[model samples]
Structures are given as C-alpha cells and as structure tokens.
Target: MSRITLELAKKMIENAEKEANQIGVPMVICVVDEGGNFIACHRMDDAFLVSVDIAQNKAWTAAAMKMSTADLARVAGPGQELYGINTTNNGRIVVFGGGIPLRKIGQIAGAVGVSGGSVEQDVQVAQAAVKIFEDFE
Candidate 1:
C-alpha cells in the first residue's frame, strides 16, 4: 500500500489552517504516517503551546488504531469495549474528536490531527484536512 506523501501532508495542514482561520481559532495540526510516525506538523500563530503534543498524540492515536479518535472515544468510555485502552499506550492515545485516519485508494495511509480549540472546533479543522486527502489525485 502506498503511504501518504509529504506533499499531501503539507496540503492537509494548509487546508486545516484555512479552516481554523475561517473559524477564528488558531490551531496546531499534525500528520502521522501509517505506522504512526510523525510526518509533519503546523502551529498557527497564537495557538497554545500545549496543543503541539496534543495534536501529535491525536494523529498517532488515529494512525495506530486505524480509526478516528472520535470513534475511539465512543468505545473507550467506562463500561465500553475499549475501556482504559488509552492508558495502555503510555498515555499517548487520545480518545476524542479531532483525529482522523487518511485513506488512499481505499487503504489507511496515515492520519491528521488538530488542536488549540474546543473538541468540536478541533474536529472541524481535522475534517477539513481530511477533505484534502479525500480529494487527492
């Protein structure tokens, strides 16, 4: 399977930044390869410093798990199937919105994450980035 290219990762970040700007929220965006390795990251002006780590971990979680962090959140809660799973990955797993796996030719290629806003806002930015991946040539 082909992995996400560096060019695509950058495009994802650019689209994410545009969405964040449109919403008036500075953001930290991260991309990870299929193996959960860091590919690229961007911190918008005025974004919180803490968002850097959050965004990276979110991308890692999505790539490693091969699922959106939002979907993971549903099953990671108390009494759910993946309960306490987040604590197993040295606390790097993020069980929330704002992380999504990127697919290429029907295969998971990588993931993108966004932070520096509310969960909903972050999710919006992340979704915008994923749209770039979806439309990639």
Candidate 2:
C-alpha cells in the first residue's frame, strides 16, 4: 500500500486551515500514515497549544483503529475497556470528533485530524479534508 504523499498532506492541511479560518476557528491539523505515524502537522497562529496533542491523538486514533474517532467514541463507551485502552495508549489514543480515516480506492491510506475548536467545528474541518481524499480521482 502506498503511503500518503507529502503533497497530499500539504493540501489537506491547507484546505483544513482555510476552512477553519473561514469558520472563524483557529485549529491545528495533523495527518498520519496508515501506521499512525505523523506525516505532517500545522497549527494556525492563534490555535490553542493544547490542540497539538489533540490533533495528533485524533489522527493516531483513526489510523490505529481504522475508524473515525467519533465512531470509536460512540462504541468505546465509558467502561473498563475504554479505560484500559486509554491507559494502554498512555493517552495517545483519543476518541473524539475531528479525526477521520483517509481512503484511496476504498482502502484506508491514512488519517486526518483537526483540533483547537469545538467538536462540531473540528469535525467539519476534518470532514472537509477527508472528503478531498474520498473525492480524489
């Protein structure tokens, strides 16, 4: 499986940043490989510092789990298993909105994440980025 290209990562971050700015939300966007390793990250000037980890975790969760962070949150629930996972990951894995799997030809290629905004706003930015991959010809 081919890794996500740097050009694609740049485009994803640029598009997500633009969308976040248009919506009046500063954000940190991150992209990761299928193995959940960082490909690239960008933080808007006004984005919160905490957004860095949030964005990274979001991407990591999506790549590691092969599912959207939002979906994982829904299924993980508040329980022993979820708690264990959190502990196992040492806080690297996050179940939240803002993270989405990146697919190419219907296979997961990587993931994108956005942070430093409300969950809905983050989701919107990440969704837009993911859509770019999905709609790529």
Candidate 3:
C-alpha cells in the first residue's frame, strides 16, 4: 500500500499506546498521511491536553518534511541550515523527537507522532509505531 490505511494507523496508535503504558507516561499519539493530513489520533487517559495539537503537528511535520523530527532537530538548531524552520509553515513544524515517517518499499507512506512525555519516552512510543509499520505484511 502506497498510502496509510486506517487499519495501519490504528495499529500504529495501538503499538504506541502499549509503549507509553510500559514507559509509564500518558501520551497523545497521532498519524498522518503523506500529504500531512490527519488519519488517526489517540489521547491516553491523563495525557496533557496541549499534546493533542502537538502530536498532530509532529505527524504533519514528519510527513510534510519526509523525515523524522529527531533528525530535523539537528539541522534546525541555532545557526543551522534549517534554523527558524519551526517559525515558518505557520508554526506547524516540530523540531524534536517523536515524529517519524513510515516508509513502505523505500517510499514515505505516512508518519507517526507521540507526545505528552519526555523526548525519550515520546521517541520510544513513536518508534514502537514504526516497528509495527515495518513488521506489517
């Protein structure tokens, strides 16, 4: 499948939620298509309300930029090539961890984002979602 299906999005969220629970952090998980359109989102119990928008923005940033936000963060730092990029795109771009593109056959299919935790925890959850995507048949 070239695009993210609802089934895959839901699976990604499920895997992310499982990771969040294991990490003992409530999270807001989001999935988006290649065009940066929302596919699915989940707010765990006790998750920060503000994470709702952040999670989706992370997903959008990943899909639109076609790279993980963690990688983007490196180039987006002060005096870097993409410095101030977050200020552009109407402030929708996130320059940190927890946003990852889902690739199928070396093509970007969609993305997953997780928030409401520390950067490490969020990245763990997003990585879990990517694991599901990679393991899909």
Candidate 4:
C-alpha cells in the first residue's frame, strides 16, 4: 500500500476544517496512515479537548480495518465476535460515523476522521476530506 504523504494529510485536515467552519461546527480532524499511525491532526479553537482522542480513534479504526467506521459499526453488532475488536485496540478503534478510508488507485492509503460535533456533522467533515482523495485522478 502507498504511504499517506504529509502533503495529503495536510490537505485533508485543511479541507475538513474548512467544511466544519462552513457549517459553524467546531471539529478535531485526524489522519492516520495504513498502519494506524497518526499522520496529521487539526483541532479547531472551540473544539472539545476530548475530540482529539475521538478523532484519532476513528481514524485508527478506519486505517486498521481498511473500512469506513460506519461499516465497522454495522459489523460490530451486539454480542458479535467482531464487537470486541472495537475495544481490543486499546479503545482506539471507534466504530462510529466520523471516519472514512482514504484510497489511492482503489487501494486504501489511510483514513481521515473528524470529531467535536454530532456524528452527522463529523461524518460530513470527514467525508469532505475523503473526497479529496476520492476525486483525485
């Protein structure tokens, strides 16, 4: 898999921030590489401190699982075997709506996540950032 470059991470963060700002929603954005390592992060001034950790967890879940956090939530049904995966990663695998996989040439390159707002708002911000990669030729 291709590595997520600093430039790409920066762009994703910037776009996510812009989207959150446009909607008047404060947010913390995080990007994680394929190995679930942090690539970059941004927290809006009014964003909650806890949002940083939440965003990172969302991104880690996406990167490590190679799927959107929304999908993970579906598979991690109550009492399902995979449900434990959500907590197995040291509480760093959040199966929520604010995370999305970053793809390059149809392969997962990394993940982007957003927090500090409602799940819908956070998902919107994260999706805006993921669009950068999705739309890339």
lDDT leader: 1
- All models, RMSD in angstroms: 1.0, 1.7, 0.9, 1.6
Give one clash count per candidate, in the order shown.
0, 0, 0, 0
Error of 2 at 57 (Å): 0.9
TM-score of 3: 0.97
Residues 111-131, candidate 1: write the lDDT tens digits. Answer: 998999999999999999999
User: What C-alpha lDDT does candidate 2 achieve relative to the native structure?
Assistant: 0.86
TM-score of 1: 0.96
In model 4, the runs with Cα more than 4 Å from the true position are 79-81
TM-score per prediction, in order, is 0.96, 0.91, 0.97, 0.91
Model 3 — which ten-residue stretch has the worst lDDT?
Answer: 1-10
lDDT of 4 by residue, 1-137 (tens): 45778887887788888899999999999998877888899989989999999999899888888898888888897886687777685777897799898877788788898899998999999998988766555
Summarize candidate 2's per-residue lDDT along 84-116 as a digit string, tens digits: 465557878787788998876677899998999
Count: clashes, candidate 1: 0
User: Mind sharing the TM-score for model 4?
Assistant: 0.91
User: In terms of TM-score, which candidate is stronger, 1 or 3?
Assistant: 3
> Which should have the higher TM-score, number 2 or number 3?
3
Evaluate all candidate structures by whole-model CA lDDT and list the values in order.
0.93, 0.86, 0.92, 0.86
Worst 10 residues of 4 by lDDT: 80-89
Residue 93 local lDDT, model 2: 79
